[model samples]
Target: MSELLLTVKELKDIEKYSADGYVLGYEKYTFFGASRFSYDEIASISNKANVFVLLNALIHENNIEDFNSEINKLAKLDVNFIVQDTGALSLILKQISPKRVVFNPYTMICNKNDFSAYQNEGILGIGISSQLFIEETIELSKLDNALILLYGYEPIYQSNRKVLSLYQEAKKVRFPNGQLYLREDTRDVLYSIIENEYGSVIFNCKKVNLIRRIKDIKEAKYLLIDTFLSSEDEIDNVIKELNE
Candidate 1:
């Protein structure tokens, strides 16, 4: 069976659901710096299963110099790093020599040419962006490179402007700790968040379910399922539905 990857925002989820006999991989949430959890707390989740640290370019863009150190710390715990920054990728390849790193598709890699560029940089895999269609996935699979098919919701809008605006507005409301409750309208939508970063973009596109599809994905050497804050049952359901 092909492996299932899940993105988590909490460490407790890892402890409770990932303790034993769970078919899931993990990617840390790195979009906002307000996770309130230290890297040590996040990396501890890796003990449950194969864990990958997702470092968003949005977060790393501000303090580019820290990328190497961040990667180094995570590497010490034997955690794989997944990145979106070209510069950071170069750094990891040069300094850390991480066991594996998947380039986040948020950078919008559309064709084989993009894959070729990263492949030259020694990147192990490329995440097919949410903007890509099935035809693009097939084309990407044809390329002589590793591929990560985005099997979950697509991260639609990422902007320092919008999130900042929301945070500012939340501060005004004094919303108990200035925590911005960013909500997306997903009503009547098979995919949610049509415009927000975590909004739904890909729909009815055959969620990487069939074993044949999984086999096609695994053929590329690495595979992952990208989902946000998914529960244990949800994770198990996706695996069962896909594997069946």
Candidate 2:
């Protein structure tokens, strides 16, 4: 368990970031900001650092056949798989090592009871829900083999429907293809959202920026920093801070 940076070369100096490893989104299974690396690229990155692939997309029925095919190709690489969907987990288990497959269904796991149950089911590790407040999260970090997606806007909701597309069509307006945020009339907070062919995902308004507390939360095995929605300067600052 080391620091993980979720990114693509969209940010420079990833190798110089000094993270325990680098994380890339699986083109077919991971959501927004997916690096969409080719198989040769996957092999290349693994040689540089430990590679973690996020298969966090809620797999649609039609994509299963193709996604499963991608899993087979990925299994040959020395990379760890972090998955959200149960069906995707089952697919990885069929080909990847159990130790390398991590179950990370966001916001579903909160307390020790839920975590214990997943452990009982033979899941080696799981990402702790970011919904838990600071003190509560510190307590859960005491548990063995836990991981925290400490910094970044965690995706709170995902749907198979193209909500944004429907909105654009109905309104007859175009939104930028880059990240967009939705805000309620009275609320100051804005929720980040993006839509692709797989679906739309709404991210938490308040990012879980806990980089400053890294030393205090030593019991947790892994701490993750996501670079999505961040510029090279932003992520560069983060990496420098973490290593300091």
Candidate 3:
């Protein structure tokens, strides 16, 4: 059976459509500067579905104090925590027992060496980047680790500068919804939008998709199918198609 990993928004929709029976996983949009959810919120959501929560280290530029508190609360709920950041990772290892933690893609774990380093740190899984060639994935599978990706948009560039400025100037207007978009050369914009538009680009790098590379992930210890705003329907459809 195929496994799926969804952003918080898609998971919300899935809960509505599946009547709280759909197995759930959560990803923190760290690049977006969104606030961490409270423990009560986490438990409420997790209780609604078989859920695992990813702790975003990129949130507010990786506030260690806040990150620690959030993970502590999640651990109290007995919810699975996927963390990014060396400081956060080290803190979790030292403060929280290893049983409730998972490693997140934000850790930038790219190879077997990276994987080996985390194994003893109680990391149960490692997310492989979509940019990796098939050979790299084959090598990754040889290591004992769970891996995840989805057949959707990959996050690409991240910046400290407000990206929405470019769009406002080009369009000669501001967004009514107050959403931000970075301006780039026309060609660069198109390529970036197509290749890395899902995860927040303001802070985290763009995520790469491997929809065409699903077969490679099958060899992984676990496969996490991801979905963000642009391809929610596509995610559900893929899951249905693959599972059917």
> Candidate 3, which segments miss by more than 4 Å at Cα?
1-3, 10-29, 32-38, 59-62, 105-107, 165-173, 178-215
Better of 2 and 3 by lDDT: 2
What is the C-alpha lDDT profile of model 2 across 16-85, one tens digit per residue? Answer: 5766767777657777653566677778777677787877887879889998888878878888888888
Q: How far is candidate 3 from the true structure (C-alpha RMSD, Å)?
A: 5.3
Residue lDDT tens for model 3, 146-192: 56555445555545444455656888996555333444565344322
Error of 2 at 88 (Å): 1.4
Per-candidate TM-scores read 0.68, 0.90, 0.72
Model 3 lDDT, residue 102, Cα? 61
Best by TM-score: 2
The global C-alpha lDDT for each of the candidates, from Candidate 1 onward, is 0.53, 0.76, 0.54
Kindly report which residue pairs in candidate 2 clash with one another. Answer: none
- Per-residue lDDT of candidate 1, residues 88-195 (tens digit): 777778877734676765647887887788777676666666456656665676665454543554445554444443654878753343222343376443432222
Clashes of each: 3, 0, 11
Off by over 4 Å in 2: 1-5, 10-12
Ranking, lDDT, top scorer first: 2, 3, 1
- lDDT (Cα) of model 3: 0.54
